[model samples]
Each structure stands twice: as structure tokens, then as C-alpha cells.
Target: MAGNSDPLTPRAKIAVTAGKAVAAASRAAGRGSGSVIGGRVALKLDPDLLARLAQNLDVVLVSATNGKTTTTRLIAEALRAAGPVVSNALGANMPAGITSALAGGSEARYGVIEVDEKYLAGVARDTDPKCIALLNLSRDQLDRAAETRMLAENWREGLAGSKAVIVANADDPLVVWAASSSANVIWVAAGQMWKDDAWSCPSCGGVMQRPGDDWFCGECGFRRPTPSWALSGDHVLDPHGSAWPIHLQLPGRANKANAASSAAVAAVFGVPPQVALERMYQVQAVAGRYDVVQFQGRDLRLLLAKNPAGWLETFSLIDPPPTPVILSVNARGADGTDTSWLWDVDYTRLTGHPICVIGDRKLDLAVRLEVANQQFQVCENLDQAVQLCPPGRIEVIANYTAFQDLRRRVGN
Candidate 1:
């Protein structure tokens, strides 16, 4: 994504300077969203800052309901092997965050951005990315992001007009519907574990039939597109049928899928699959998702689960049976105010495992666990939750703010 290959106007330069000043002050004051506010101010002043900065740059945009941040990080790391690559390090994925990241890296020629699912269309319009990676879509922040089908429609409308090549998940019906009309498209069979949001076909509104991994709409005859890239067991299969084993430091089948999706995107930019997979192993953590930190003689493995789909994936990452787990929930603004999504998750999966529920919304989670017939204890403090777990290492699964708070408290 590059602008018109023209110099910035005098007004835009001043706006950038003023915005950076405010961002500096905000950071000095310990405010987390310094980049967000800084970008907002710059956009308000210049209005065309994104389009201006994007001119003459090779840009890749990544967006999805889940795994976007990690996928963006992987793609960014792969691009770094070629040249300077600028990307939003923080998970702030809106237009403002993208603007702030681009503003901070004025010297970089390559830009890799994690665009929010809702803002993908608008941001893509401004940046005009060279390649757009569309990950799986699921229900998230219902209060904030209205509905899943609507978001899919918006993505379809936005991407249909872009000249960029699209790399999308063929397993996700919603992603297939959104990118089907794109001029250039490469589909990847990155596994889709969460099928709750895609039960109804976005194409015909008919109940989708998924006898196995493939899904098709009986009403409209829309079927899962044939994927050029697929995952065979633990390896990623390329279009030529060559399989590459993806060794990621991050644990989980979900992350393996992310690596496969990212490798397909890197290939679009001429990066070899072997090279991309090699660079991905260097990424040990994204923000604070899979970080393991020590707290009061206990090792805490931090995992974030903001919604039902996230919770489902995270549950699979933790060890089964013997290992104890901590569940943290918060109804803060960063996490949607409604904690009802908790009920949607099949917490019964925890069956015989020992669980410690902790956070502002711990009681809500405790109640849900009780109904699921799973026994759990409630501890509002992280330290106490850590003590409740067995010695050595314990897993801490938390939502947005709760996870951030755990990271801060443990100094991770």
C-alpha cells in the first residue's frame, strides 16, 4: 500500500509533529494508548495521512476475528528478511493504530498491518495493500461489532474493489464468501475449529452442511472452495503438494494454522515457504499471548481468550487432566461489558481438571462452571490463584484487560 509518490503537504508535516508530541506525553504519563491517540490527532488534522503515507510502499494487510496479531507478526518477520518492514507492534488494529505505526516508521519501505475486521474495508481503501490475508471470522464483541454475517458482507464489499491479491481461509465459509469475488485469490485450508458462527451460510442464509472438514450450502450450492494450500497433519501443504513442517515456539494447533496462513501470504511476496517457516520459529510470543512468567515461586503461562471462540482454542492448548488452570474474566471496556459469551463456550471440556476462577467477573465464570458440572474455586487475586495451582508451572487463561493485568502484575 503506497500513496501517490508525492511529498507530504506542509499542513500534514505539522500534524505529524504535534501528534508525536502528544504521544510522547501520553507514554511518559503511563497511558497505554499513546499511539492510538497520537494517530487519531494526526488523522483529525490531516484527514488524508493514511493515503499519503501509503503511497509508493508495498503493504500487506492481515485481518480476522482471531489470530490476526500473531499472523501479522509472522508475516512481518518473514518480510524483515528482505528489507525494512513497519508494522503495528501493539494489538491496536484500527485505522489510528495503523496510522501511528506507519508514522513512526517513515523510513521503512514495506508495511505489514493487522487491520480490524470491522475496519478492513476502509483501511484497505486507504492503504491499497499489495496483499490482503483474510483469516477466519467468528462472533466477537457483539456489543461492539454488531453481527458476524454483516461484518462478512462489509469485508466482501470492501475487498471486491481493491487491486490487491487476496489470501483467504477456504475452510471458513464466511471468508470464502467475502473473498470469492476478488480479482486475485489464493485459498488456504488452515483448519477452522470454531464453527459456531458459520452454521448459516453467508451466501444463501441456508443451514450449511459440514459432514466433515468441508462445508457447503445446500440451498445456494455454495461449497468450500478447493484450497491451494492445506495442512496435512502437522505439515503445511503447498499448491504443488510439497509439505513443510511448521515448527512454531508457540504451542497450539491454532498457531500452526496461523503459520500456514502466513506462509501462503509470504509466498505472494516472493518469500519461499522454507524461508517463511524458518523465520516464524523465531517468534516466541505475540504481545502477551503465549508468554510464561514467574510469579511468587510459580511459573504462569499466560493465554488470552476474549470471546467464546478464543476460549475454545485456548482450552485445547493447555495440558489435559492433571494440569491445573486459572480462568480470569473481566467485563471491562477493553473486554466487552457483556460476560454472556461465557455460557456459549463448552466449559464442560474441563471435566475433571482442577480450575481456579479469578478476575472482576470471576463469579460469573464460577456460575457458568457450576452449570457445566465442572468444579472450580474462586480467587480474585492473581497471587492467590497462582498459589492454588500445583508447584512448577500453571496456566493462566484470561480475557483482554484481565490478561493485561496479569502480565503487568507478574512483570512479564
Candidate 2:
């Protein structure tokens, strides 16, 4: 009587082998279930599968171009302050991935997932979260995202009908204004990044001027206001002294914004303001995101920049240590959808130093590095980059997907 509980004996293996082969042959013949969950052949399940699953949970969906992972993790932590929780901690965010993750928690009281922008509307319809967190949007992969406007457009459409109590970023007019239409919006603001919210309006195609920290259209009069949950600059802590006391284990302005957005959302979730401030102060830099590690006995800070804002933010956090740098990029999907954003990054900060540029796209990155006329060591592969870097610790900034993959290979 072999079943899930019984250990597989040799005879059991011999018996199950036939069934496994039958399923495999059927799958190879295009007539079997694509995947197995709960011991069922599940190739062509109905679209309402997620709805069926979520009937048992209080789902929370988080989506944004930046800070979704960190913010979602912390929000789940705070939410657990409310009750039992289940989530996709490894970040498989596609609808299928969410379905896979949501499958395991038939008994959990709550579910929180970070959904990609492309899949948010579909997931929202299926999961029907009672609470939603919308972080700010910025230019990321124009090739895949098409353009900033399209990404924004998709978000607006996804969030249009949600009855969830929305936790939104006020500083970003795009997120704030889109979510503002919700009946009960929980506003969140970070310290002002633009001294003025002035900009060229993507809507109505007009010029925008900052009237205080909020933006107002000079022509069409489309306005973006601040959020309901915000931290006074006084609570944030940074030696750079920008009025906010935000402490990033990884230093930079964009990180401050990330932390602020996370904090503001935490407040709306019912984490008291003081406790939210304390928890944010406790934020540790995820490896490769301004991660400081010891490499070859040298102190190395790893900053991964996948977009224009990420690159700009990494530059802000560069309180470089004694060892120089290993600025790496790659042709891998993780490096970027397109490397054009590299042009927007100010790489002049590394000029005149002996820097190493490593990746499959070394020549491409070298071309960008050369424009600054910086003397750098170029390696087309990771083994070579690690070889050239001195025995002492150093700082490394990687872009896009290459950040985590490169650091895991090099840091050890």
C-alpha cells in the first residue's frame, strides 16, 4: 500500500516507475497534465483556479518597478503582527508562480505576494486582496516595458476596480494620482526628492512646475499631491544630512525613497509610526544591493543597478572604501532588458581609478566606461574578473539581473 506517507522502497519504485513513464509519455505526446499539484493531473485547469484557492485566504498583492520585494517582505512582517501569514518569499511573481505558491497554503489565514506589473490585473481579479500596496514607478526596461507611459497605463488599468484599501506612495505623482481614485486610499510620502515636483507632464502633454513638493501642470492643471502616511524628515538618519534620518545599510537617495515608501505603507497597515521608524532603521542591505561583504580579505560594497534610477542611486551611496571597484555588467537577461539606461548613469565617479568591468557584455560596458576615459580592467567572464581584483576588499556595482548572480559567484 504505497502512498505519499510511505518511504519509496525498491519494489515501490519499480511499481511507480511504470505510472511515471506513462505520464511522461503522455506529456511527451502532448496529452498529459503540464504540472502536478495535490497529486492531480493539472494541465488545463480553469482560469478560476486562483479564485478557488483565494476563497480560503486574505490576499495582499504588492506591485511596483522598485522596492516591491523589500516592501512586501516588511509589510508581510507587519501584517503578521495582525495574524497568521503565507507568501511567495522567493519571488516567483507571475500568475502561474503565484498559483504555485498559493497552492501550498490552503490552511493559512493570509497571503501576500509581490506581483509583476504585467500580471497585476490578472492576479488581482483572481486573488481579490483586501489590501494592496502600490509602490512608485520609474523608467526600467523600456524594451520590455515598451515605455514608461505604457507601464503606467497598465498599472492604472490593473488597479481600476480593486476594492482593497490602497497603500500608495504620495511623492510619485504617477502612483499617488492613479490610486487616489480609490475610495479609501492610505497615502504614503517620503521626504521630497525633487526640491520641486516640477517636470514635463506625461499627461495632457504639458509642462509641470513644483508648487512646494507637489507637482502642478502649467497648462492642463493635472496635479499630484502628497500621501496621508509620511515620515517627518527628522525621524530619518543619514550622515549626508538631507533632513531625513533614513538609514540604508546601502547608502543612496533612491534607497532613502525605497525605505520611505516601505515605512509609509507599514504605517497604514497599522504599524505605529514610531515602530515603523524603528523597523526601517533595522533594515539590512540584501546581498548585492549595496551589500558590503569581505572578498579576498578586502571590504567590498556591492551595488546592483538595473535601471537609470538604480544607477543614480548607487552613485549616491558610494562612500568608497580603500579597495577600488569591480563594476560588472552582462548580456544576461538579468543585466537589463536593454543597456541604453547605462547612458543615463553618471559613471564619471569612477574616473581615474583602476576599475574592472566584467560580464559577457564587457566590451559594451567598456565602451561606456571609456567615454569617461577611466582606466579599467575588463574581463568578459566572472572567473577572470575575480582573478584580476586584488586580494583586498573592494566595492562592486552590478546592473540588473547580473547583480545577484554575479555576487553569488564572486563573493565566495
Candidate 3:
């Protein structure tokens, strides 16, 4: 006690922490240990021991410009129809993140995660997944993710030696390039003629016609082989519906694409197409994608906007701008470090006055609306926004993490 010294230095503390974490995890694996959330266990975990319990562990990984969350979640559920699975339900797909998630789930025969674009290389190195699913790519988060194609190139390098069966969207130009070098790549084509896929030659930027549902570049012989799995459709069901004769927890055009992605992966696991499609049709929408909330006097459409692709998908689902809408930006730099992505979102698609601006960067959204020439109000606080919401009807659009916080505020 005579001389006070730093009891544990930073390096020592890290070693001690990792040791404790691993020991705790090892103990937690044999027993189902979890914390309470929204008054439910919410998720289940068991760590490495639980993963050791699984049989024939054929892990699947999904990466995308859009659809990662909904797609991965759907794949997890579909796999449930087949067997046990270990997955980070919250899309934590980094190296340390995946290690923690996989180590936590001890009772799984498969592992899956919705990986971030920039973190793919690290996660792939750690997991070496057997079945990989890749979706589309688009310009998003230029500050953090340089460019979508650059990220896609990195994905190819990460998957080069992986002994995993790969599923790719054949209509995407970048996806075509990524799958070119992989021997186990299973190409899937979803028949969305909309602007989602690459219909033009990458070299000349001229429209490359699809001859018989197969894509080829007219400007150059740069083309890819046909996909192993495919879907043909227009205007798939919207997730906003309360329930369907065929229940899909996640619904919408992008969701349809999400379902197709899950189906492709499930098929790779030897799950029959009929079984996967049935699973897709049977799920209902989750909390985020166009989740509709019924408040005391208001009907709110809670649309999630994180990246440009997500917002674009949201806009595609909405017929027209819902009047008297409220937009929330979690500009605290908490959810995402950058709030400038608002520049990429086409807010002009909105046609009416925004009743409230919610979140720490409330003014940022308010000002952005002004710059976009859209009329809006600044409630500043979320409660104030809730109070000011049009009594009968209103739309509320929130970004990733903000959406959950907003839902809790409205008791949704």
C-alpha cells in the first residue's frame, strides 16, 4: 500500500481478459447461457463446445450490397427446417466478431453470418466457410468502403483457396467476376429485369442483351457461365402485409431476392428446392424491412434505411411517398460513423412535408431535406416527434440502429 502501482498493465489486462473470456465461453457452451432482451431470451448460445456437438458442419456465408441481414436470417430459418445451425443473428461477421459468435453457439451443425463488405477478407480467413452466398453490389459508403467493385475484388481474393461451395447472382457484373475463378461457384439468376442487375457490358457500358435468360456482353466476349439456381419473377410480395396465405416474415421485391438467395444456399446443402421455397413463403416480415406499427392513433410505416441500396429497396416497395412522414437519422456516429450517406439517398422521391426529424443529428436530416427541396419539420427529440405525429396516419423512416430505438419508443 506504500506505493500505488498500476495493478494490471494494458497488455496484461488483455491477456487476462482473453483467458477469462475463453474460460467463461468454455463453461457457457455446455449449458444454455443467455441474457434477457425485450423480455425474452431472444437468442441462444453455447460457444465452441456446442459447435463441437454439431454433425457434418457445412457452414454457409452470405455477403451482399443489400439483403445480407434478411437473407442470412432467412437462410438460418430455412436451415432450421433441415438441421441445427450456428449463426450471429445480428450480422456480426468480422474476425473477432465471428469468433465470438461461433464460440458462443456450441450446438450447431452449420455456421452463417451476414458479413460486412470491408471485413470479408478477415472473416473468410478465420472461418474458411464451405458454402458462400454473394448478392449484388452498388455504390455505398464511399468514405468507408472505397467502392463496391473494390470490395468485390477483395472478396475474390479471400475466397480463392476456400474449399466452400459458392452461390452467386449471375446478373451482377461484379459477381460474375468474383465467381470466375472459383471452381465450386454455383451461379443463380433472379429474373428481375429492373435496374438491380448489370444488363450492360462492363467495357463499353452499352446494353448487353440477355439471350434466353443467359447474359453476354455485346461489346466484349466478357461473359459468365449460367447460374446453377435461378428465379423468374416481377413485383414479389411486399413485407408490409400483416400475414399472407403463404407467410414470409420478410417480404418485398428485395426480400424476394433475399428468399431466392437463401433458397440457393439451402439447395447447396442438399435441401430440396420445394422445401426451401415453402420455407420462404411461410416466413413473416421481421422488425426492420417495412415493418408497419400500429400506435394508439397513428399507423406508422417503419422503413429501415442504412445504405443507398437498402434505401433504394425501401423506395421500390413504397408506391409513392407516404404523406406527413417522419425521418430519423441516428447521426450520433453511433450506428454508422458517417452521416453523409444522406447525400446518396434520393430524398426527392418523398412528396410531402416531414412531420418530425428525430435523433441526435435531427438537424442534419432537416437541413438535408431542405437542400433536397423537400418540406419538413424538426421535432428534434424522438418523443416530440412521436407526440407530433399525425394522429391518424404517418410514415416513419429510420436507419439501422435507429429503427430499433424508435420501435422501443413507440412500443412496437
Q: Estimate each model's TM-score.
A: 0.97, 0.78, 0.75
Answer with 1 or 3, whichever has the higher TM-score.
1
| Superposed model 2: Cα runs more than 4 Å off | 1-46, 191-198, 234-253, 277-290, 321-323, 334-337, 390-392
lDDT, candidate 1, 246-323, per-residue tens? 989999989989999889999988888999999999999999889988779777789998888888999898977768
Comparing 1 with 2 on lDDT, the higher-scoring candidate is 1
**Candidate 2's error at 296, in angstroms?**
3.4
Q: Model 2 clash tally?
A: 12
lDDT of 2 by residue, 1-412 (tens): 1012323344433423443444466558765232232112221234455565566677778887766766666656655655666776656577655665555554566787888877777788877787778876677765666455566666677778678878777667667656755787766665434221225665665776776666777897777654455555444322232334555453555555556565555545555544554555555654335566765555667777666665665665665543567777765654445777677667887664458887656787889888977778877665566667766656677765567666666553
lDDT of 1 at 19: 83
- Candidate 1: minimum summed lDDT over ten consecutive residues — where? 1-10
Off by over 4 Å in 1: 1-6
Superposition TM-score, candidate 1 onto the true structure:
0.97
User: How much lDDT does each candidate structure score?
Assistant: 0.88, 0.62, 0.63
lDDT of 2 at 89: 60
True-vs-predicted CA distance for residue 150, candidate 2, Å? 1.7
> How many angstroms is residue 180 displaced in model 1 relative to the true structure, after the best TM-score fit?
1.3
lDDT by residue (tens digit), candidate 3, 1-412: 0112333344433433453355456457742222111101111232232222212355777887677777888888788777777776655554434544554444566777777777766655655577788887776544566565566678777778777788888777777777666778877764433344365555456677676666677776777566555554632221221111224655466776677667778877777555666776655555445667776656777887777667766766653444567777774443565777777777787756445777767877778888888877788566567677655556677776688778777776
Candidate 1: clashing residue pairs, number: 6
